[model samples]
Target: MNNWKPRVSMGIPVYNGENFLREVLDSLLAQTFEDFELIISDNASSDRTEEICRSYAAKDKRIRYHRQEINRGPAWNFNRVFELAQGEYFKWVAHDDIYAPEFLAKCVEVLDRDDSVVLCYAKTKFIDSEGKILKEYDYQIATDSPQPAERYRSLVLVNHRKHAAVEIFGLIRSDALKKTPLLGYYARGDSVLLVRLSLLGRFYEIPEYLFFNRDHSQRSVKEKQVQIARGRTIVAKFLGMGPLPPTEWFDPSRKGKIDFPEWRLFYEYFISVKSFPLAVKEQISCYLYLGYWLFKNWMKLVRDLLIAAEQLVRASYKAQKIIEISLEKRF
Candidate 1:
């Protein structure tokens, strides 16, 4: 690793992503903006991922690849790249996602001109596994508001039907990002991180559709739900600790009784407001909005709990059937 610093640091965290890893890297390498370093954090992938990354690194000095000895969860790998970044601006790139050649250049230009904007991302175009264009994502969060409270409301209160967390891939000021907790080891961790960022500064959206987010069966969100169903606690595994309180879900320092992720998100937002320089009335207004959000999502929360219980019942039935078949065969 050389000491040369780049204006932008693009981090790609992957595990067993050899299928589209080359295409992702090719897109990054062909960027119009060349003053950047590509950081690839391989989470001990057992596939040909290591080989592909190593080959690319050998050819391009701008690419620095690091392999973990053990397979950590996606959250840890995602944050690991940021910890290893040494640039003025940073962006997280998914292994299966493709970017336009001018994606980084346009984002960098926006950030260069705007001092108040902490994050800058282009509009998104969803694509299938075969690279065919799906439809354009239309959900928008009001992150460009000059008022911190408005930005917080936009990020936390809005309900996006599709691609809700795509803005997490945007280029961000390193200083602003360093101040906030990177990513939690929970299901909606990316959404929570975006909320924290909105509390810090405004976000700028580039008008062009330069971001290509791929949707497939093997996406991380689906894989996480599968792991949860298999009786694996992702947060505990990622932290390398036993079960923790709900407070520690977002704040690693605190130990309190268990709570839902949505409640914890509100708690995090309150903490952010308290930590920053907001007026007394503005702080109250933000808290009021949090209360309203809770009221709005209460039905959804109950529905989600019912769905979770149904899934648990189904999994238990499957396991019991498997055991019964084994016993019959032994007899």
Candidate 2:
């Protein structure tokens, strides 16, 4: 084999995505920038996802497809794609999203020209399941700010934009992404990632609508999020949305554990802040901004604690009942 590495690595972490997979693949393959590798990690999907991936991989030298023996959850799959990537730059695209032909070319141009820019993403338009444009996302966070603290504060308030974490899909410096925890297995981890990336360097937003985010009822954020309290998670909190997802959504190993997503998100943000080396003033500003976050999310934080306590009580009751049954049977 030849030791060939592409300029950019596009990773698609998908599960049961056959329905709209073709549209995304076609869009990426048709990108004006052809010097990129496409890596797809299938999460043991029972649908025709495997067949579809194999078909595409066979035809395209740039495509690499991998299927897991069992479901490893979204976090593992998301990180797996990155581990397999050998490109100078990276981007994570959802299987259901569509991109314009200039998306990759434009993003690569920005990253190549600006060493200070850690990530570059185009303006986004939300599309329905049938590929019809629902609305265009015009709000732009100050991610391009030269001040890291300002970037952090802007991303923390991304929920006010009433859009999901679209910037997370932007072309990013592989080294910068590697410095942070690549997507944690907690609710709203993507936002945490963007904030961390911003701390590393600047973010550039192209002034064109080249990215399309498909909003469907079956999407994970919508489907699993509804199981929790509405308007509580990062994606939904702005709309008074629900709380974190249950176990096994992000990682299967964390099954049956009490998940305090809001609290987890709160703690992760602090960890990101502590991990980065900022000026004393910048660090203090970040901390101060976090205090504002705490005040705003105090309700969600309280809910997390209450939820954990309830789960503990339920677990104790179940364990006691099981033990009683075993003892009675022995007698």
What TM-score do all the candidates reach, one by one?
0.81, 0.93
| Model 2 C-alpha lDDT per residue in residues 1-331, reported as the tens digit of each score | 8899899999999999999999999999999999999999999999999999999999999999999989888889999999999999999989999999999999999999999999999999999999999999877688889999999999886664375788999999999988988988876778889889999999999999999999888877633554664334343444464556764567779776767778778888898888989999999999899999999989878776666666688689999999999999999
Give one digit per residue, the lDDT tens place, for model 1 in 165-257.
889999999999898878876647787788888878899999999999998877765344543543344433443432212333333333232
Give the 10-residue window scoring lowest on summed lDDT in candidate 2.
230-239
lDDT of 1: 0.80
Using TM-score, give the best candidate's number.
2
Question: Model 2 scores what on Cα lDDT?
Answer: 0.87
User: Clashing residue pairs, candidate 1?
Assistant: none
Native-to-model Cα distance after best TM-score fit, residue 64 in candidate 2, in Å = 0.9
- Score candidate 1 by TM-score against the native: 0.81
